[model samples]
Structure formats: C-alpha cells, structure tokens
Target: MAAPGPVHEALAALPLVDHHCHGAVTADLSAAQFASLLTEGAAWPGVSPFDSPAGVAVRRHCAPLLDLPRHAPPADYVARRAELGWQEVNRRFLTASGAGVFCVDTGYAPYPLTSPAELAAAAGATACEVVRLERIAESVAAGGVTAGGYATAFEAAAEAAVRRPGVVAVKSVAAYRTGFALDPERPAAPEVARAAGRWLARGGRLDDPVLLRHVLWTAVGLGLPLQLHTGFGDADLRLDHADPALLTDWLRRTAGTVPVLLLHCWPYHRQAAYLAAVFEQVYLDVGLALHHTGPARCRAVLEEALEITPFRKLLYSSDAYGVAEFHHLGALCFRQGLAGLLQDRVDADELSLGDALRIADWTGRDNARRLYGPPVSEPARDSGGPPTRKV
Candidate 1:
C-alpha cells in the first residue's frame, strides 16, 4: 500500500459528485431484501448471499460504520442494521460518502425509495434527476396514446420531463432493452410511427428495437448529456452485446452533438476506455463494478479503466440503488482504489505527486462539475438530517 501521505489525504478531502446513481430505499429492508440489494441475482430460499464477495465486503467495511467490528458475522451485522433502522442507516452511509451532488437516475425501481428531493435532503447534498428515455416512453404508452399520436405524445413528455426543475440529463437502458447495435441515423417518422403503434398495441415493456432506436434519437434531440448503460448489469443484459465497442458507429454519428456518458462499464471497461480515448464526447465510469470488486480487487478495475482513457474523460459514479449501503460502499471503494493506484505511480516516479493530486480531483469531482454545472448550493446537514443550503 502507498504510505499515508499528501496524495491520499488530498483524494480523501475532495467531495465526490456521484454522477450516475439511483435513489436509495426509504423503507428498512428485511435480511432478504438487504441481501438482494448486495447482488444482481434473485434471492434464493435458505441461501445466504452473504457468503459472496460483496456480502463479505459489506461486513468488512460497513460494519465499522454501524459500530460493529470489521468482518462481523452476517447475522450480527444484519441485527445491528435492524437496531439502528432505516433513517439512521441512510444518514450514516450517505453522509459518510462525502458526495456533494447526487445525479440520480430515477427511472429504475422508482417506488418504495427516496426521490431526488428526499435523497438530497437526507444526504445533505444537492440532487439532480436524469430522465430515463424508455421509462418515459412506457409512461406515454400506458396513457393509451393512439399509434399515430404516439410520437407526438412521447416527444412532448420527454421535453416536459427535461424542463422539470433539477433535471440535468437523459439516460437510456438500451443495453438492457435492445443492445447498442442501433442504427446511427435517426429513424424516419413513418418508421417510428409504425414502431410506436406496434409497441402500444402490445402494451407491455418497451423493448422493440426500432422503437428503442427512435427513443435514442429523440433523446439526442433533447441535447442534454446522455447516459447509456454500456457494460455490466443484471441478467437482462447480454454481456457480449452490451460492449461499448458496439456503439462506436453511433458515437461517431453523435459526435460533437451531445455528451455521451457511459455507465457501469466493467468487463468491457477497457473497451469503453478505448472509446473514451478516441471520442471527444465520450465519458466512462466503472461504478457498479467497483463495489462488487471490493477495495481489494477494485484497484485493478480502476487501473484498467484509466489505462487508455484520457484523465478528463473518466467520471465518478456510485451507480448505487436500493440500500444506501451501495452508495457508501461505492464511494469508499473508489477512493481507496483510485488513491492507492495513483499513489503507487507516485511512489514509482511514474507520475508526479502534483499530477496525481490534480488527476484525482479531476476524476472525483471536476469532470462531473464541468458536465452538469454546479449544484443548488453546497448544502450542509441540519438537525434532524434535513439538508440546508449554504449561505
């Protein structure tokens, strides 16, 4: 490990802007619910997900924050979590993360969770929403829009959502729905109308490829920073197809138009890194991968992500969802992994200590600030845990 020094201290002191993440659970989770949050898999009866790396990492890291010893047994840790209850747990973890702004993706698993306003209030940070393109389309479909009117209705809804207060960007789960093998050109109006008609007739999920293409094109038209899930995710993603490399053609088409933020690039992070290296508008983050990798292995993931990517093209995100523990663990692992990697280079004289510190600030906060602008205010925690804007 790099010796405790100025570089480590500097990385620790810089507040993060969790640029891509989800709202935390508002209700206290049962042990099963909590364990479910730790992994992407479904909870199996009588099986302990706690035996996994993420489970063990949670016990190792989060235990101490809850006043338990490191590596507390799963039962002990879960029991203690129950004792403190939801609000305290959220406060303990969110405050500890040192995130000044949470750019929350509020589309997935939206219910029984904190809203952006609620998250900012509890975390004592500013919060901004990223409009989910597919979710908006589904909502528009659910309202019984006729085939011919679907395009107009969807467009109006997306525009209204973007214009809403505190909404800063748009997101697409194309990786989950249709994969990145999308046509770079915008879909024709007739083709989009046909796709929309078929999609509304089905009245279910919005996974049609033509319709999905149309959604992506519409999002580009909105002209906000667009986030795409490029790499690792739940079982819904076909890992091979979700590769960022597949999007190069689309990236080339969208160049100089909108900023494309790639989220949770793992196994394909190196590929995402390559894209970020070559594309001026491309940005990447290894958020979901970091927590599961834990501090021990996350350094390698971070190293791979940084290898070919420009320093400014890398962004920090927790990709946190459900429990606030993910938000905490993501930040904790990122800091440890990044600080350790840069400090090692500094020790080997591969990079100047000054360069390491500046790079750390750029990845941790500055890049996101440049992309999203400033938060509402540098809010501070008030009594009872409501966030208060700085004077």
Candidate 2:
C-alpha cells in the first residue's frame, strides 16, 4: 500500500457522520452465525464467506484490531473473536471507526441487538434514530387495527414515532417490500383501506404496493429527511426493481418535498448520481457496498457516485448491521478510497487542494450535519492536520 498523502491524511483525521446504520449485536456469535452475517447471501454448507471480497477485507483490515496479524486464517479470526468476547470486539471496532455520530435504524432485528444509546456508548459517539416506516406499519397491523381506520392509525403512529426524542429521520424499505415501481400518487383512503384489509388478512410482511406508496407519501408529509433503500440488498429484493432510476417518475412528483436519501446504490451508483444531480431533494451514499467491495474496489464505486453528484449531496454511512467490523471497515474504505480519488484529481490539477479538502469534509461530516441537526456531542477532531474548512 502507498503511504498516506495530504488528502489521505486529511480524511483520516476527519470524524465521519454515519447517516444510516444499525446496531451491532450484543451477544456473542457462533462461527456459523458470524459467517451468515458476513454476506448478504445465505451461508451454504461447503462454501465459506471467507473467500469473498468482504470476508477477505475483514481479515486483512479487522484482524489486526483483534491483536491478530492481517489476513489471519478464517478459523483463527473466528476463534480470536470468540476469545475476546462481544463487548471487547464491539469496543475495538466501533471506537476505531472514527465516526462522531451514528443515525441508527431501529427497525430490523432478527437477533437481539444494541439500542441506539448502547451503540453510541460502545463507539464513544452520539446516536440518533431513523424510524423504519415498514416496521411501524407492521406493528400497527399486529395491533389489530380495523382496515377502515388503518390509514389514520398508521399516520398517527408514524407521527408519534418521529416525535420521539433523538429521532432524526424516517426510512422506507420499499425496495425490499414492493420496490419503487408503484403508482407515483399517494393511495386514496378507499385504496389504502382495501390494501390494509388484504395485508391484515394475509398477515405477513407488508408487501402491498398501494400501502408502500402510502407510507412513502406519508414520509413526505412528516417533513424529515426520508431515506429509501435503493439498491443492493439481500435475496428478498428483486435487483431489477431496486434501481434508483426506477423511482424517477416518483422523484419528479415529490420533488421539493423532504430530502430523499438513496442508500447503498451499488451497480446503480451512476443512476443515483443522476438523481442527486437533477433533484434538489435527493442525496446518496454508497455505504454497504463500501465494506463489501472493501478498500480495493471502494474507490471505483465512490468515483461513480461522485461523477455527477452535487458535492453537498453525498454523505457517509456504514449501513452496518450485526457485526461491528463493518463500522471500522466502512470508515477505513471511505477515507482511503475517497482520499485516493480526490488526491489523484488534485495531482492532475483537475481540482484544487482546498476544494478537494472541502469535498472530503462535506461528504464525510458536514453534509450529514446539514441534513440532520448538529451532533448531540461535539464532533471529535484529529490532533494534527491542515484545518478543514466548513461549508
């Protein structure tokens, strides 16, 4: 690896604001459990996730934090993790991430996970909430609300959820639930009641397109930044419907509403860039893809996302769930990858050093601050470096 340049040093020293992420698991994970969390895909009997890019990157980057050598064997790494226990592992990784703030999605949890306060304490950072619309809707259904009253009940629930202290934003997993290819218009009262009746009867995950559109429009009414999971998720998502471009018509209809943040956006990062460029209310981050693509390929992904994206419209996030290693790995990749790309531009005289540094600050921290409010705690600054200018 090359030595750190001025740009790399600047980014390395900057504390990041992870605009979207989830809590790390509190309990110790068995080898199989750990393997399952490593990949978005299911763990097969013969194949190990350790051979993949994300797995290799974890060994190469995260092993050293556990007092093991870089690129340690998978068995050795897992054993070392078990030996250290969950708390110590969480502490080492989250603290090493250098993120000053974490906006956690308190929605999906198949296993017991840390709360926002707990996660923040482990990382020594401030934490806020990003309420999941789908989860709230599911809870409303589970409560046995009448279909005719469902819309009113859901809107009230969503309103109350966002009013909770420390709640910064609301999110929709429409891509996973029904994708973005639905009617651009908000569902009418009768349509919502019909959809609710069907969903309540079926009693499964909320997948009704009408209801998904309703929740999205409801998010717009709430007036907080709205995050939509755009591309690159688990098997539940149909990749074809997950493209950010698929929401172009809807984006046009809702233009000037609450900021719509497109999360992940791998393979379709270029499309996301186009949206951010054209839509004032749009922003994006290639977060989960960062740790999965790892350091080596993260730059390419970042480059494409930044190709036409407005400087202030890009933010940083780990989208990390379950494992704490992703918190550290995501930050590492963002700093190293972004620095390399911006530094190259500076070297080529395509961009000035000052502009490069400002772009770094905007994407890493300031953009998020501008979207959400200021951090609960003052952001931690690195000891010695050229001062970063604030936008």
Candidate 3:
C-alpha cells in the first residue's frame, strides 16, 4: 500500500461510530497487570508481552499518542504512561480515536473500567450499551431459580435487561461457553428447566447448552441486534468450534427477525465474509484483531473479510477493553488498512475515487449509524454543533 495520500488523509479526517467495544480501565495498572491486558494469554514466567505484534503495535502507534517517540522502549512507554496517569492517558487515546459514538458491550469487564457514560464523557461522544446474554442468565440463576420457573425466569431476565435504557443490542459469548455447534431450534421448556436445575445445583458457571440456546432466542425475541463472539478470543474459547460457519443453522432460524453481528472473525474471516454474503442478518468486524495484526499487516485481514462480504454487512469496532490505547490503535489500523486497500483499487483504476471514498465512509461511519440508529450529536469535526439524538 502507498504511503499517506489523499485517501488516507480523507479517512483520517472522517469521524467514526464504533459499533462494538468494551470500556476502558479507570485506574493505573501495574506492569504485570498491564502486560496481562496486552495479550489474551496468561502471563508467562520470563517472557515480555512487548515481544509480540500487538505489543510492538502499541509501542509504535500508541507511544506517540502519549507524546513518546515511535518505537519507544517498553520501559520508557510504561513509565511515561504511569507518569501521565489513567485519566490523561484515556483522554488522549479516546479523543484521538475520532469516534463520535461508542457502542459498548458492558460485559467481560475484569478491571475497574470506565462506564459507557464515563467513556462518552472521556471521548466527548455519545455512548450506548450492548447487554451480554450470558451475564443476564448468570444473574437470574444466582437469584434462586426453581426448576419449574427456570424458563420463565430466564426469559423475563433477558427481556428486562434488553429493555433497560441505553441498551441498543444483545451479545453472547457462546463461543466461549457451549460453542455454536448446538441445535439452532429453541430448546424445549423441559430441557431448559432440567439444564437450569443442574446448573443452579452446581452453583457454578453457566455452560449449559440448553440455557445458552434459551438466552440467544430470548434476545432474538426482544427484537434487538445480536452480537456473537465468533472467533479469536482468550484461551478459554475452543477456536475450532468458534467458527461463524458453525452457526449457519442458527442464522437460518434467526434470519429476518434480528441482526446477527459476528465479532472478531480472524482465521475464519473468509467464512464470516461468506455468511455475510449469504445471510442478510449476518455482519462482521475483526475488532482488536485488526490493530493486533499491526497497521502494516492488517490490510490482508480486511481484504479477506471484504472479499465477499457486502459493504453494508461490515462494521467498525475496537473490542477494546481494560485499556484505552486499543481504542486509538484499532481506529488507526482500520483507517490505515481500509484506506490502503481502497486507495489501491482506485490507483489500479478498478474503482473510481468517488466510489472508494463513499465505501470508506460506509465502512467507517455511515453503516454503523444506519445499524445502531442516529448518534446524539456532539461537537464533532464536521458537525455544526452537538449532534442531536434521534428520538
């Protein structure tokens, strides 16, 4: 891909609406804690997390945002970050992300992170929440459910959670739990009750296949977009089973009823692209994987994702959690990767400059706006004033 040119400049200037992401950490982290957040794996004995692609990317892209030079030494970067503190670091990265809106998944938080409201305040943007289905199920189960009332209780919890103010969608980490290999048809009442009985009796995590399926369909019944963790997560996920293609049957059943967003489909991005091509409800984003691949190499992942995926079926997300740097890095890599790919087509005369810029807008901002509804206007780059919320 060519160096920064007109297309890259245009993309950099365009505002974004991050359609799926998580909150940023609120407190300063220790070195180990910070390193732990850099990768999906457990901290090892003597290895530096900075040795990886994601770590290098952080040093390269996020270092300068913190006022450090490019490729800053790991110790220097961490010390500089500590010196600035979380609030300043967060403000620098979140504002620099250029996202006018943040659609945050308010689950999977393991740290003292900012709330969607806090994140909105930090970035000077509007924020909406995406309820996680499993968390709701676990909450309901912990509230003393009986075998007979399990199905109704779960449905009620799911309904109530999604109905809450600011919840624009529902999400599931089923790939981490039962995977997508289960029956697509809604579980029978008796099966769900029995499963719940076993789970509540165990008083442990909710990996029950029946309960997981129930949560999914209940979310669908609520008539909100459903985001599923399809591929590339922490070690807990069975990567082989997390493929989006495994959910084909579920897609067929949920089609036309709800939008199904597949998140972080990395190795199976082509499969996700195919599903997006075939199913109107299916959509995708590579999220953290984009910037994790680093700006220079992320274009291939985007290329694979866009090969057959409809332009509208693609969306933007950072899937950023724990740290605000991801919010910046994800946007940076996405702009670099997408602009590089689109600009190449224009240079090759395969796409008109007008079409390339239009597609860029669609992927970066407009598509997310259409999917999630209008943003509450802020003092955005191109905005006349604070964007008014869609009633």
Best by TM-score: 2
Candidate 2: which stretches are off by over 4 Å?
374-391
Question: How big is the positional error of residue 223 in model 1, measured in Å on the Cα after superposition?
Answer: 1.1
List the candidate 3 regions with Cα displacement exceeding 4 Å.
Answer: 1-3, 374-391
Candidate 2 residue-wise lDDT, 246-315, digit = tens = 9998999998677889999998989999999999889999999999999989999999899899998899
How close to the true structure is residue 155 of candidate 3, measured as C-alpha lDDT? 80
User: Tens-digit lDDT track for model 1 on 258-314?
Assistant: 788999889999999999999988999999998888888998999999998999889
* lDDT for 224 (candidate 1): 81
Model 1 / residue 44 / CA error / Å: 2.7
| TM-score, cand. 1 vs. native | 0.94
Candidate with maximal lDDT: 2
lDDT of model 3 at position 49: 82
For all predicted structures, in order, the TM-scores are 0.94, 0.95, 0.94
Screening candidate 3 with a backbone cut-off below 3 angstroms (N, C-alpha, C), the clashing residue pairs are 377-386, 377-387, 377-388, 378-387
| lDDT score at residue 30, model 3, on the 0-100 scale | 84
Distance from true position, residue 327, model 1, in Å? 0.7
Candidate 1 has its poorest 10 consecutive residues by lDDT at: 382-391
Give model 3's TM-score versus the native structure: 0.94
Question: What is the lDDT of every predicted structure here?
Answer: 0.85, 0.91, 0.85
- lDDT accuracy of residue 10 in candidate 3: 86
